[model samples]
Target: MFFSFVLCCLCLSVYADTDAVKSVSVMEGDSVSLESNIPEIHQNYIIKWTFGHPENRIAQINKEAGIFETYNDVLDGRFRDRLKLDHQTGSLTITNTTGTDSGDYQITIIGGKKITYRFSVTVYAPLPVPIIIRDSSHCSSSSLSSSSSSSCSLLCSAVNVGHVTLSWYKGNSLLSSISVSDLSISLSLPLEVEHQDKNTYSCVINNPIRNQTTHLDFSQLCQPCAIRGCDSAEAVIRLVVTVLVGSAAAAAVAVLVYDIRIRKAELETIQTSHRPCTHCS
Candidate 1:
């Protein structure tokens, strides 16, 4: 009987805790309110707000005792002056929230009855605009990965983004994606496409609440690579130049041979004409 009673109490505690918890999400530098449905709150009633596992008391109010206190200085002054309390509803608002402020907030009210409210709050940093750039390393590599003269190598990237995803989309179809949760992470996703492709492509960086997109311009980023070999006009020009140079060299050689032979003949005639009587017999 004791074991059964203990089990029943445990189950009831779990159920009540789950039922009272509400989820809240906001961007960094934004404000979020944790609502406590204690209407007509006055000094005669006591409302206290606590946070985190140990549940440090951060705020409280009591009208009759003239006590309205917010202990924002507990956690290294993280809360500081960014906390606001609605005395009428006993709701607590946190302004200029940072990721460090994300956690569970619990409010305990003591008036006619004791009531507790729980909140799970999350603060996410703002997402940066994603950019698309040519992946020049792949484009200039000597291996098969090189951006062949017909293809474009590209990458979509974003820096200083937290709790977001970077994705590549072709038309309406998704190509690839990467996600990061660290406070300031850089992410990149690669894509390859034909230079002449006419389909639409875009890079996107998105968080749960907002997104930014950059469209790909094939014509602007990846112009057509000129073919390596020459065209017919270039080939014809080379052949003509070769023939003219060969003809000019052949003519110069023939003229030099003719001049040498004529000079030899003139020398032979002069020697015969001047034959003296050295062996006149």
Candidate 2:
């Protein structure tokens, strides 16, 4: 009978805990308000707002005294100068929240009936700018034209992003994407694609807070092919020029040789005619 009674009490405590807790999320360096639904405070009421545990009191209001207190010495470093209380509503506001401030909070009201309000807070830092890198370390500008296909691997990465999505886009089309709901972490996604002519791509990192994007131009990546085409055109032009120059030189040499032979023949005939005339006289 005693064991059964203890089990019932434990179950009731768990149920109450689940019912009292409310979830709240805020970004780092931002402010959040933990609401307490105490619309009216009696003259003899006492309101205490605590962080994490009831022992670590942050703020409290004594309706009888008509004054409020902000705890500094007990809180140590947290909520030192950024704590505010709305005396009318018993709401607690925290400014410049940090990751360490994420936890459970409680408000205990001592009035006609003792009532408590619980809050579960989460603080996240904004995601950093994502980076994109080519995965093929062996591929260089000089080797791009030598490869039969311009396809290569790429990686997009981001750090300290919580519950965020990372995606790769080929122009307006979504190619690949990854997401994590776990704690803030560094993550990366890989994609392989052919570096076709003048193709455009972009990488995007986004969450509920903010988004960042980086763009890629395929024309720049496949520049080696254009360079190779230019080199081939230059070789063809040089070959044609060499053939024309050699043909022109050969024709000039043939014309000069023919003229020299004709002159020599004419001179020989004149000499023979003059010698024969002398003999006859």
Task: Please provide TM-scores, in order, for all candidate models, with all chains considered together.
Answer: 0.67, 0.62
lDDT of every model, 2 decimals? 0.78, 0.75
Each prediction's total of clashing residue pairs, residues at least 3 apart in sequence or on different chains, is 2, 0
Per-residue CA lDDT of model 2 for 1-281, tens digit only, reads: 56654553443344344355898988889999987665555566688988876558889999789868888776566778888888777789999999888899988876545667788898877777788776644254455557633665678899877788999998889998999888768889987676654567889987766678988655543334344354446556878999999999999999999999999999999888777455465
- Record all residue pairs in model 2 with backbone atoms less than 3 Å apart, i.e. clashing: none
- Candidate 1 wrong stretches, greater than 4 Å: 1-20, 42-44, 141-147, 227-281
**Which runs of model 2 end up more than 4 angstroms from their true locations?**
1-18, 53-55, 138-148, 160-163, 169-175, 180-184, 197-201, 219-281
Best by TM-score: 1
* Leading candidate by lDDT: 1
In model 1, where is the ten-residue run with the lowest total lDDT? 224-233
The number of clashing residue pairs in model 2 is 0
Give per-model CA RMSD: 16.8, 19.4
Q: Model 1, residue 135: what's the lDDT?
A: 63
